[model samples]
Target: MASVYHINKGINRPIVFKGFVAQYIAYLAVGLVLLLIGFAALYVSGLSLFIVLPIILGLGAGLLLVVQRLSKRFGQHGLSKYLARRKVPAFLRFSSRRLFTSLSRGGIIQ
Candidate 1:
C-alpha cells in the first residue's frame, strides 16, 4: 500500500519536481492528451454521446482534480491516492512532471 507521499519521496528521499513551471507544462500535456483521446474513442467506438460523455467528462475531471489539489495547497491531502486507486484510460498517461507536481508545489508551471 504505497501512499502518494511515500512514492513522491524517492527511494533516496529526493524531492521531485524541484520547480513549479515544469510541472505546469507536464499537466497541460497530460490534460490535452486525455481530452483528445476521449473524443477519438467516442468516434472509433461509435458509442453514443451518453456513453462517451462519461469517459470524456471523467478523464477531464480527474485531470482537474489533480491540478486543483496540487495548486490549491502544496501538501499531502490524499488527492493522488484517490487518483491512483481509479483506473485512468490507457490513452492517457500520468507523467513525471504531473507526478511531481501533484506531490508538491515545487512545479515549473505558475
Candidate 2:
C-alpha cells in the first residue's frame, strides 16, 4: 500500500512584501508577453488595429488584477486578520480568493 499526505495546517511567519513585489513584477512581465502575443496574432491574421487593441487591454487588466490578489493571499501570518481589524472592506476577502488562483496559476507566490 501507498501512503498519501495532505497539508491542513497554517504557517506562522513574517511577510516582508519584498518577495511579493518581485512576484508582481514577474506577473507584469507575463502580461506584456500576453500583449505581444495578441499583437502578433492580430498582425498575422490581418485584423484591424482597433479590433485587437481592446482584447489586449482586457487581457492585461485581467492579469494585473490577478497579481494584486495573489500578493494578499501570500501575506505573512495574521497580516490579513490585522487588516480586517483595521476595517479593511469585505470585498477584499473575495479578492484574496481570486488572487490565490492567479498566483497559483502564474507560479508566483505558490
Candidate 3:
C-alpha cells in the first residue's frame, strides 16, 4: 500500500501566465480593459481611425508602461495595500488623558 499526502500552501502563491506572474497578470488585464473601453468610446464618437488609432495606441502604450512599473514596484496585493493605505489619516491624535480631564471638569459625575 502506498501512502498519499497533500500539502496546502498559503494562498499567496504566485499566479503564472506566459512567463509573467502575479501582479503582472492583473496589470495586463486592467490595461487591456481600459484600452478597449477607450478605443470603443473613440470609435463610437465618430472619430476617424487615423486620429483614434494613434491616440489609442499612444494611451495604451503609456498605460502599459505605467502598469509595468507599478507591478514591479509593488508585488502581489500591492495595489490593494496602496489603496487601503491612502484611506488612513497621516496623523492620528490620541489624548485619552486630556479627554478624561475635560470630562472630570464637566461635572457630569460627582
Candidate 4:
C-alpha cells in the first residue's frame, strides 16, 4: 500500500478575494454593512423605495469602486505604510541641545 500527503501551498499568504487582499476585504464588508443600515433607516423613516434604493445603491457602488482602487494602488500593507508616513514630521525641531548633552552623559533629560 502507498500513502500520499497533501501540501498546503497557500501557507503564510494574505487572504485575497475577488482581487482584494487582506484588510481591504474587511473595509468592503464594513462599508456594505453601513450601507445596509442606512437603507433600513431611510425606509423606516417613510422615504420612498425609489428614493432610498437609488441613493444607497449609488453609495454602495462608489464604495466598491473606491475600495477596489485603493486595494490595487496600495497592495496589502502600503495603505498602512502611507498613513504612518503621513504621521511622521517633515523635520524634527529642538529648541535646545539639552537632549544630546544628557545622552552623552549617559542619562535621559526627562
Candidate 5:
C-alpha cells in the first residue's frame, strides 16, 4: 500500500511572483505600464537612446526596489490597509442628522 500524503494550502494565501506578493505584483504591473508609456513617448519625441534608456532603466530599477520594499514591509494586505486608513477617517466622520435633512422648504425646486 502506498502512503497517503495530504497537501493543505490555507485560505487567502497571498499569491507570490518571484518574491513579490499579490498587491506588489499589481503595483509592479502599473509601474511597468507607466514606464513603457514614458519610454514610448520619449522615443516618439525623437529622444536619443543614450538619454532615454538610462532614465527609463533608472526609474524602472527604482520602481522595482520600492515595490519589493513595500511588499516586504507590509506583508500581503498591510499596504492596502495603510492606503485605506487615510480615507477611513473621512468616511467614518459622517453625521446622520445631515444625511437625511431637507435642503429647502419645497419638495422640489427647479
Candidate 6:
C-alpha cells in the first residue's frame, strides 16, 4: 500500500488579505482600533457626533490609504530594509590610518 502526504501550499508565504500583505494587515487593524478609541473618547467628552464622526472617518480613510500605499510600495521586507538603510551613515569618518596600520599581516594588533 502506498500513502500520500499532503503539503501546505502556503508554506513560507506572507499572509495577505484584501491586498494587504503581512504586517500591513496588522498596521491597518491597529490604526482602526486607535480610531475607535479616539471616537469613543471624543464622544464621552461631550463632543457632538457631527463633529467627531467626520474627524474619525477622515482619519480612518487617510490611515487606510497610507497603509495600502506603503504595502504596495514596500512589499514584504522592503520597509524594514528602507528603515535600516536610513540608519546607516552616509560616510564613515576615519581621522587617521593608525587603526589600519596597527594590524599585522598575519595577526591582529594587541
lDDT of each: 0.63, 0.67, 0.80, 0.97, 0.88, 0.95
TM-score of each: 0.40, 0.45, 0.61, 0.93, 0.68, 0.90
State the weakest 10-residue window (summed lDDT) of model 3: 12-21
Candidate 3, residue 107: the lDDT equals 50
Q: Give the alpha carbon lDDT tens digit for every residue of 1-110 in model 6.
A: 89999999999999999999999999999999999999999999999999999999999999999999999999999999999999999999999977777676534655
| Residue 88 local lDDT, model 5 | 66
Ranking by lDDT: 4, 6, 5, 3, 2, 1
lDDT of 1: 0.63
What is candidate 4's lDDT per residue for 1-110, written digit by digit as tens? Answer: 89998999999899999999999999999999999999999999999999999999999999999999999999999999999999999998999999889898888843
* Model 1 C-alpha lDDT per residue in residues 60-89, reported as the tens digit of each score: 888777775674454343445557767666
What are the root-mean-square deviations of the candidates from the true structure over C-alphas? Answer: 21.6, 18.5, 4.9, 1.7, 6.6, 2.0
Error of 3 at 27 (Å): 3.7
Query: Which parts of model 4 are misplaced by more than 4 Å?
Result: 1-3
Clashing pairs in 5: none
In candidate 4, which residue pairs clash? none
Task: Summarize candidate 2's per-residue lDDT along 23-94 as a digit string, tens digits.
Answer: 455666777887898789887899887888888888878877777666666543344466677795546346
Highest TM-score against the true fold, candidate: 4
Write candidate 5's Cα lDDT for 1-110 as tens digits. 99999887766687899999987899899999999999999999999999999999999999999999998999888987888997765544555654435445444452
| Superior candidate under TM-score, 4 versus 5 | 4
Q: Candidates sorted by TM-score, descending order?
A: 4, 6, 5, 3, 2, 1
Model 6: worst 10 consecutive residues (lDDT sum):
101-110
Using lDDT as the yardstick, the better of models 1 and 3 is 3
